[model samples]
Target: MAIMLYYPLIEPPRDVMYQGLLYWDMISTIVPDLADPDRESGWVRPSMMSPDMAAVADAGLYTPLSIASHVEPSVGIGGVDLTAKLRAALADLCSEMPERELKPRPAVEDPEQEIVYSDKLPPHCVDLLLENGLARVARREPMLIVSPAVHFTLLSVLARQLAHDLTAWQRVADRAEPCLPYTDQPWAFRLAHLPATGKPERCWQVELGGLLPVPDPSVPVSEVIAFRLKYNDERVRLVRAIRNLLRRLGGGEDPDEVFAELRAELADALSDLDRASQRRRVHWMRRSVSVLVALGSAAGAKVSPDYAWLLGLIGGYAVNVATTSMPSLPGDQGVDLSYLQRIRKAVE
Candidate 1:
C-alpha cells in the first residue's frame, strides 16, 4: 500500500486544524522545552522522550541535558574571545580532511532552529489518515471524522506510557477479580465509519490496557517495522469549588456531606441565571458554564448538577446580549447568537 505521509503545519489552510490541535497544543504541552521536529537539531533526547517512544530509540543515542542556574564569576578574566581562532583552525582542518570515513557535523549558529520528526504518529497526525485518497482531501472537514481502521492505528500509537499505566491498573483489578480481555468487554468496542457505503462500523478498541513489568522493557523490535508511517491552557476561577470538592475528592479535606451541599448551592445559582428575561443572555451564560462542567466532568466530577451553573452563566450572558441587540449592530453583526445558545444548552 502507498502510505500517505502528511507533514504537519506545512499545508497552510488545509493543515490549520492539525497545526492548532497537534503542533500548537499537544506537542507543546507534552514537550515544552524542546525544538519541534521542523527545525534542525530539534531533538528530544530518547531517554527524556514521552513515556511511549523511549524504547524505540537505540540505547545510547538519546540522553538528557542538564540545566542549572549559577551566579556569575566575581573575579574571572572576561577578555578571551575564542570564536575567530576556533573557526579558522576547524575550517583548515576540515578542508584538508578526506570525505571518506566521516562527514563534518554542521556548525551551530542559530539556537532557535527546530527539528521535527518522530517515529510514531501522535494523535493529530493520525487524523490525516482520514484523507485516504487524494480525492477525499477536497471533501468538507474530512479530518473531522475518521475510519475505525485509522482510529485503531491512532490509539495503538498513543504513548505506550498510557498502556503501561493501564496494565498496572489491570493487575490490581485482576487481583480483585479475574480481568476479562478487552475484546470481551462491551465498552472496549469503538465505533468507526466504513468508506464507500458510508455506514457505521464497530471494532475492538485498541489494546492500550495492560500492566507492565518492573523496569519497563523496550517495546518488541518487530512492532516498529510493522507500522507503515507516522506522524490546553485553563485556570480554575472558583476557589471554593476546588477547596470543598476537588480537595476532598483529591484527599485533602473532609466528608461527602459538605461536597454534596456545595453542589446543590451551585445548581441553584445556575437555575437563577437561566431564568433571566433575555433568552440570549441566559444562553450566553449557560454556554460558559457548560464549558466548565465539561472540563470538570472530564476530570470525573458530577456534571449534571453543575450543568445548571453553566446553563445559568451562558443563558444570563446570552439573554443580556440579545436584549441589547448587540450582535445585530451595524458593523459587527456577524456573531451567531443562536449557535452560541445551542452550544450552551448542550452543556446544560
Candidate 2:
C-alpha cells in the first residue's frame, strides 16, 4: 500500500574543455611507449605531435584501455594512473567481482554511460517498473517488499516518503469523525499475521521490526482525523436514523444501546496509541496495510479507506500529501501520493 518515491535535481553537463586529460592519461598508461614530442618525456608530457598522430595514438589504446581501465586502481609509486587498481578495489568492495564482469558501456561516448552491474539497477529501470505495475499480476502478493537491489542512498528516499505519508494520514484522519478524542493518545502496536495463499504460506513481513516515535512533531496535527471521526460517528447516526424501522420489526433492545456497544468496540480497537512504541507502530502501519489488502483479497473482503491510508503509509505518499503544499504534488495521483515527495518538499 505504501508508495515510496524520490525527486532529485539533476544537473546537465556544462560547457568546458575536457582537455582530453582522461584520454591522454588513459593512453599514457596503456601505450606509454608511443611518442609525443610536445613537452613530455613521460606521464607529465604534453603532446605536440600532429593532432592526427596524437589522435591515432589515442585511438590505438582506446579500445584496449577501455577494456582494461577500472573504476579504481591501487596506490602507485608516484600516484600515477591507478584506474585499474581502483576498479579492482571497487569490484572487490562490490562482492569480489571478477575482472571479466561484463559492465555496461555505450558504443558512443555518452556521459549517461556510467557504471552498470548485474545485481544493481540504474535509474532507467523506473519506466519498466511502473509499466510492470499495470500489466503484472500482483507480483509477490500485495506486500510492498523493499528491493535488495536498493542501496543505502535509495533507502534514504524510502525513509523520507514514509515520514510524508504519516503526515498526510494524520491530516485526513484528524478531519474525520468521532475523532480519537485527543491529539496525544498513546498507542502500542503489534504485528498481526494474515496467511498466504500460495506455496510460501506466509504473508509479507517487516525485515526490521520495532516501535518508533512520531517522526515529525513540528508538522501540525492533520485535519483528516476529524473527518474520520465524523465518518465513524455516522454509523451511530445512521442506526438512530433508522431506529423506527428496527422497532417496527420488534427488536428487543433500544437501538441506541446496541449502537453504543458497536461504537465502543470500534473505539476499543482504536483506543491505545503508545507514543513510546511509535517506531513499531509506524512499521506496523507500513507493512500491515499491504498484508491486510492481500489477505482481504484472498478472503474476498472489501477494502476500505483505512486500507488506502495503509497504502499511503507503506509507500510514503501520505507524507508527501500531508507535508507538502498541495501545489507541490505531482499531477499523477500515484506519484503525488509518494511519501518521498512529502519528505522532499518538507526538506526543500
| Number of colliding residue pairs in each model | 37, 68
lDDT of 2 by residue, 1-348 (tens): 111111111111100001011101111111122224663332212342433324424444211111112111222222222333223223332353332222222232332122122112122232333342311212332212222222121222212222233334434556321101000101100100101101111111111111111223222222112222333343333323222222221222322344344434333322332222242232112111100101222321221222211111211222110010111211111122111111112210
The model with the greatest TM-score is 1
> Please, what are the lDDT tens digits per residue for candidate 1 over residues 154-198?
222121112222233434555321111111111111110112111
Clashes of 2: 68
Q: What is the lDDT of residue 299 in candidate 2?
A: 21
- In model 2, state the lDDT of residue 186: 10
Candidate 1, lDDT over the whole model: 0.21
lDDT of 1 at 9: 16
Per-model TM-score, in order, reads 0.22, 0.16
lDDT of each: 0.21, 0.21
